[model samples]
Target chain A: MSEPRNVKNLKDRINRIEDILASVAAGDMDARIETEIEDDLSGIEAAIDLLIDDLTDELRQREKMQKELETKLKEIQEQQRTIVQQQEDLLELSSPVSKVWDNILILPVIGTLDSQRTQIMMENLLQKIVDTGCTISILDITGVPTVDTQVANHLLKTVTSARLLGAECIISGISPAIAQTIVHLGIDLSTIRTKATLQDAMIYAMKQNKRSDEMKVLSRNALSDEKED
Target chain B: MLELAPDRNFELLGEYAIETEYDIVMARQTVRQFAKKAGMGIVDQTRITTAVSELFRNMYNYAGGGKVLIERGDVESHDALIITCIDHGPGIENLELAMSDGYTSGMGMGYGLPGTKRLVDRFEIQSKINEGTTVRIMKWK
Candidate 1:
């Protein structure tokens, strides 16, 4: 049998080990059993230290990935905001027009036209015509590289809406490739009045303006001359 | 044991096509194959496959079951491929609310529908209360 003093010492040792384990379980990796004894308790301490090391490495990797994901998400949100702001500015600039020449309004579309931009363009153009009381509108598409059915449909809707508002829309400056695409798509643009160049459409609009001006002048002069007689 | 039919237009292959929670991955692969067959470029194929995968996972988690259909449409000179996903289970009540990012009904991050819409050239959605939902997406080549 062991002496009473040795039993007390062993009990104390076990209590110390238990306290260290409790601390470790509470995520205290620094709390380790440091007794100068060659026994099973040392092995337990070594195994626990290894487990904590693995856990720390895993937690560090997780944090790094989380930071990277957050950075990427921020970049994407910034990009989306920039795109939205650009579209808004463009819409503001392109939405208003004064029909100074024979009630004709010109809308020049530039840049790569995506489906969303095309839809916004159609809405802006139609709304402008309704507000300005214009009888004629010209759409120029020289900078567009391609056209699809959805975009073409948006354009068609714009023209139809303009006609309903008692205005005529003339599409001009369609590139050769775009014309081929329109043909291959078999879209019925027979009812639309399309001009090959913006210069041609402008000249046509100016001629219509002159005719209306001449008619007005004739009516006023006839009334004055009749009053003089 | 069942007897085999003499008319054998079907050859046996290692085919494991099923519709379940785990089938989302297969559905995404099917969409990618369809896009490739429709002659999409590598970048576009990747974008479309990612978007479709998002929607397929949503279908598995939210609707529990859905249908996928792929077809080709010639828009002008462009050959556009269309994929449609339809589901009858737990139709979205408020589409606008559902489309908002960070708004989730369960565990998802809620980026599926909006992200899918952004990736495609044309997106169409038709859903009714107590009925079902149909989402049509088109990618132009």
Candidate 2:
């Protein structure tokens, strides 16, 4: 009779373990072998629960690391984008074209001159010429330390481009070193009008503006006199 | 023969490649940082950065592409910042003509090389017709 009773207890414990495993297989990570029977099978059940806990912890850790990696990547990309934007802004700030007078535009270029900046300077000067219908543009380079052959050429191109838009471009603030470099490079600035200082350039531009205004008035008066005649 | 002195305590500040216009801009910014770190004033920083910009542009335009290495170290008795530009492009055939102003194979103002030379305290260039060109410049503080 005792043998039968012990066998019945063993059978009950086995059924409980099977039920717990079935629940675990069905995706219930919370399922555990809760039978209090202190037998050899209990040790196997404890081991299975420990393995599930370890797997769950590992998966959580992997997920957290993946999130951290994604965040770091996003930060790096954002920083790169910001750097690009700042570069563009710096270029724009370095070359500023403004209308200082009624028919005069002034672009005070400071710092070093690069091809890209020169291109931007050219575009800005040309656009200002069109927008303001200004007849004269002055490029002031008082703060510019040096001009290489390429930058000088870009200046020439900018002047020519402005001329095509029916505006005259005058470059001012020619440092002695720059003048020497220009001559050494064999750049012919003879065709272009240059000034020694920004003030000189401004004076010249203003004088031209006044002269044009006076000419317009004179021509209008002459037409009136012709009509009367 | 073009290697930096092994005895000098030199550190690589930054490095960049000249492949496009954007890369030129990046090179300028990098040079600016290095110039600042070397305690160069704003004007000197601008000059160095401008030189770098022109060199990088030349590398991209003439060489098709090249690399620039920025280094800082004590050379001789002076603390200097060194910039090295290397290009695997058609080397200059006539070194003298190339060094002259207004000499360009392209429709450029031909101020790239000579202008770069003037901007730095020390400048050296080596080239072979079919091999490549290397330009090294140093600005001392």
Candidate 3:
């Protein structure tokens, strides 16, 4: 309830209301009349009406601010989601090649390696090897910058997973920094074959491939020779 | 806001190193699957995931640790993706300054807020001086 304000006349009261409104518009809500008002100045009544209108406007402004805040919040949430989806799409796109040559499958990864990408790479590689009945798998990470514990652990897991699937995973491309990081982390990759580069690993794989091929040729020759004898 | 049945589809549970910054990627993937499974439009899906990743990284790096909650709810005739991230760590003192880009908390590249804002259709941040911070983000399709 507003206090009764003392006023000399209707015109004076109206002037006071106008002054209060000016202050209110300037964001001074404390400006209010406290004096008693005399009867007969419709001007005074008009002043009172102006003060009420100003108060209503202020309330509306506050409501608008509240609405703006809510809108901002909604926007923030949508942005968070887009970031996550983009990352996943990136992961999917990064490791999409699938090919099996003979009994060996090769996955060549080229880029700045991160743990998340490594995980996806490992998962896809292992799954494909198992599905294709591949006996040997090669991972060439020559293009990768370096390996830390996280990436190293992921590689180790890939090897372990391949073993469980009855396939061997050969990791190639040991950059100097990655080798140093691995040594510093005290990670043992002795059980898993680590070649100097992807080409080296491929060469080793080819030798293994040729050795098996020669054995098969010899076995067939021996069988045919025996049949002739 | 879209009302979605609580279907916990891509579940990622693990314990990782404290200094490792890879969980940021995992969090991003989780939200991506959720948005895609919910059949959200590409723009909304992308924007929401980006904003959520920013908040998730903020928790992992600045707040030490936190969890993210995502839900789909509908309010009136609009569909929204609701993401809530809460952390019990040192809160923001100067929120206005923090929200402004280039204010690095020694975390990742300082594009956390401004970049996030660009991705989302709506964003809300509330933080106390010491009690912690809660951010609620929503995106409409």
| Candidate 3 residue spans exceeding 4 A from truth | A1-44, A88-97, A108-120, A143-146, B1-141
lDDT of 1 by residue, A120-179 (tens): 777777787878777789888775433433345557777888898888888888866566
Candidate 2 CAPRI grade: acceptable
List, residue by residue over A82-145, the lDDT tens digit for candidate 3. Answer: 9999978988888753554678788877764565687788788878876888778888877654
- Per-model tally of clashing residue pairs: 0, 0, 47
lDDT of each: 0.67, 0.79, 0.68
Chain B TM-score against the true chain B, candidate 2:
0.91
Candidate 1, chain A: TM-score against the reference = 0.68
Task: By TM-score, rank the candidates, best first.
Answer: 2, 1, 3
> Order the candidates by lDDT, highest first — what do you get?
2, 3, 1
Which pairs of residues have clashing backbones in candidate 1? Answer: none
Listed models, DockQ each: 0.04, 0.29, 0.02
lDDT of 1 by residue, B1-141 (tens): 111122223222122222573465576666667777778876567557666665666666677777776666665556777676777766788989876654667754455566567667877777766666777677898
Q: Tell me the TM-score of chain B in each candidate.
A: 0.79, 0.91, 0.76
* TM-score against truth, every candidate: 0.50, 0.71, 0.48
| Cand. 3 TM to true fold | 0.48
Residue lDDT tens for model 3, B1-141: 212334334233322222245665666667767777778765455456556656766777687867567767663445666676777768888878777755666634455765566566566777876677877666665
Q: What's model 2's interface RMSD, roughly to a tenth of an angstrom?
A: 4.7
Tens-digit lDDT track for model 2 on B1-141?
Answer: 234334366788877888876677667777878788789976567667667776787788888989898888887788899999999888889989988876788878777778778777888888887677888889897
Q: Sort candidate 3 into its docking category.
A: incorrect
